[model samples]
Target: MPGVIARILRRTPDTRYAELADMRSGFNSLAAKVQTVLDKDPYGGNIFLFRGKRGDLLKAFYWCDGGLCLFAKRLEKGRFAWPRSDSGVVALTTAQLSLLLEGFDWRQPLDAARPRTAL
Candidate 1:
């Protein structure tokens, strides 16, 4: 998770890993299928992530309190760097998920653009 997101979820339980699956499911569909198919409880408070076939869209499923929340993101320029495995599930750390969401390659998220001099 990024700084902002990390802070927001600071007190929340540890959701260190996100499940990456090749799914084009909507809110209601995912909420119903993820638990049984993936064998994961959506109400368990872990983050479940899914990517589109085109590699341009992403959806994150999370359980907050008693309800489920879905977050969707799409890249306008470059496609998101998705895992190259076949149709299956991949577990990613929070850091990797954050980089992926920002359009950066999660495998190599390096950005050293700090200012050398301060005014």
Candidate 2:
């Protein structure tokens, strides 16, 4: 998935944060809304990700293959952990973005395991 992730991250537009929006928002409404808030072209290839009002669903919009693509995911249980900012967008790192997509707490990453030898 690294290749796919690399492709998505390194597109025409840079990855960015989008304010929370309605889950029912479809292509047209979201495209226009996101464009307005971002001040960037929706079709310019930047991937805009938004959390749902209830925080259970996530919506992603971007341009791909000569068309616009909208990706949405809903968690069956826990809500997606989001930053404190709710009024506007907040930037996220690639690792954070990945963890967010995977429904994990990206804010605090776990430390790597360390092997120990005892005499």
Q: Choose the strongest candidate by lDDT.
A: 2
Error of 1 at 49 (Å): 0.9
Give the local distance difference test score of model 2. 0.75
User: What digit string (tens of lDDT, one per residue) describes model 1 on residues 38-104?
Assistant: 7767777877667776778777777787777777777788987876545456666666766777788
Candidate 2, residue 104: the lDDT equals 87
- Which tens-of-lDDT digit does each residue in 66-103 have in candidate 2? 99877777878898888876556776666677777778
TM value for model 1: 0.68
TM-score of each: 0.68, 0.78
Alpha-carbon error at 72 in model 2, in Å? Answer: 0.9
- Stretches of candidate 2 exceeding 4 Å from the true structure: 1-13, 117-119
